[model samples]
Target: MTNVVTCFLRHRTAVLLGRRSDAVGTYTGRWAGISGYVEGDPADAERDARREVREETGRTDATLVRAGDPVDIEDDGREWTVHPFLFEVDSREVTPNEEIAVHEWVSPPAIRERETVPGLWAVYAAVAPTVETVASDDTHGAAWISVRALEVLRDRAAVADDEAAVASVARALRDARPSMAAVANRVNRVMSGGDRTPGTVRDRAAAAAEAALDADDAAAATAAERCGVSVVTLSQSGTVRAALDRARPAVLIGESRPAREGTDVAASLADAELDVTLTTEAALPAELAARAPDSVLVGADAVLADGSVVNKVGTRGLALAAAREDVPVYVVAAAAKVRPDEAVHGETGDTAALYDGAAPVSVANPIFDRTPADLVTGVVTERGVLDTEGIRAVAAEHRERAEWDGGLEGAGTVSG
Candidate 1:
């Protein structure tokens, strides 16, 4: 029924609270922080907080440390939407108006000993965890970030189910690792789910991110079904490995040099009971000609608008060789790998990794390379088999305006 801004002015280890005076309209004789009814838009909550602090405590130099996610509290029949904030004050001196009888700086542990207003403790309890998780450095991969992001959103939804807050959280997560299309896809789907309450947004985001793994598995199965009896692959890709595991086809893995990612792939395939043969980059042509695999399957870090794929190094060369051999080349990847633009390839790898025995001889070892669209027979994805046209359609459908503008800014990592 009313919007209020509640601010906690904090020192090193304690916070300031006011004992309500009989002159105040509500919560008389109860302990609370500096709070007042929001007079205008919720966006003005910060300004309102500053004004409340100056008016109640006569402190004009409090620095805002954190603006927490808002919490909704039910008082009698009216609903009080409380926008919580934490401010650091240099001085603890207080000059209370008629709204307060006394001001006390209380330590966190001792706050409960004093009789506080309803849902006062719940305010910090609701917002702190979500804020902490969002600002934490523990989040790394797509799956880890997805789970952590959803946790923050769920907590945020419990307090304020506002679009602005949800969108803010989504953008932060999406920008966490721009190279990860799964993050963007999950967040975009949730944001585009129409104007719903915060709870709905949080729920949809959680479900989308949680189901991403299963969706990837389903896509891998489809890719494997499309492959032939003997498949030649370069580099290591989780999607490709999944597909190969499901298909159980005899594999010819090129020893992706500089990094030798293919060794890992070969080992995984061998462990899965699939016949595996590992060949060096220099000997790939001879190996391909000798083995004569029916198909070349690889995984894409990004599938561009032109339907070309960007993957680990040596993919372009392998595809060219496969094309010359008249073998079908398939990219086993999830739909999230599709991008609106060509990926920004990073600098070459550490040349020292190529040959420790060389000094004057220069080495060029890039991490990834582009394989032309013409070389690719089709892209196998969770959405089923997709040709160049199909990939283009996917880009048109899911690629947001922001992606088209710059293509996931600061995506420098070479991941597949």
Candidate 2:
């Protein structure tokens, strides 16, 4: 059995296909989605799909929409298992490598008219739902997703209120993205509302979720009020953006590597017509030394009971640097981001995101890191700026309530 990966790089409504060159092995001169053999780990096949697309097409901005289950096909007595992937790209510009003579972006329906590799269209059909899921996720951040999840529960409540059904939805939302503390806290809030009447429960949960967003805005505004002329931040955060919008200070952003979310942040601020300086992550300290911004502001993925802020991978470094420079580091987030329990720093994705397999290499791509409470000047929440004591009190209250609501029996523990 031979394992291979086939990637469908999509731009808007069209899918890109390359006409295989005569110099390439088998299926020469035939049209196919970017294809390659699975290397190293089978689990890394999706990563391989992305790498192949980059190598073959020179497009680095494609977002992986979905990776469907592999489909097996018999061709010339050899069994080929094709791993299919769908990526949404912004541009349609194609720069072909030696393996591909030329490329074309064709509509889905028109794909059948062209002479192509077998089962090419079938692969797309299998993964259509996956693309739809990516497209449908309106909330790009954990905070937004948490609110949306609560909204879903409220809608489900209007129908029939079953404990199993509610739990099922809660579990799916919680498990959908485990590392987001806001997701856990928000879901726990709704689940804690108990299996009361679906309407009451739904109303309470929906209200709570909406309140969280409002608090987020308030917290960001409060944090922004304390900032100086310029601020340096890493990663792309809705809370940070909100604060920046309010503060309207000169901003320096690190083009966060791997994901490059900071680039998004920079573009957004630039569009707002704010004075923004975009730089590489490595150059942050030099920028800090030269500019000396009033404060380093960031958003939290989870605000732990000890008051430590868990955020994007580079956040800890930014906080530490701010400490040395005597610049206060503030985390702006809604109270919903606070978790009663210890933070969970989830594992990141494949190493292929960092390197091509041309040479033997090992890569560590952790998505989040925790900044010690001591380094944090303050945690700006909807309730107000929380010192360590204030944070502990808030966390204790939440835990006590969660214990009662989550059916933890006598388990009501909060560590300061």
- The best candidate in terms of lDDT: 2
Clashes of each: 0, 0
Clashes in predicted model 1? 0
Clashing residue pairs, candidate 1? Answer: none
Q: Which one is best on TM-score?
A: 2
Candidate 1: residue 414 Cα off by (Å): 13
lDDT of 1 by residue, 156-262 (tens): 55456476776677677656534445556556666666654776865665566456656667778988887779988877776677788878888888888666767
- 354, model 2: CA deviation in Å? 1.3
lDDT of 2: 0.75
Candidate 2 residue spans exceeding 4 A from truth: 1-139, 358-360, 404-416
The TM-score obtained by model 1 is: 0.56
State the weakest 10-residue window (summed lDDT) of model 2.
407-416
- For model 1 the local lDDT of residue 292 reads 87
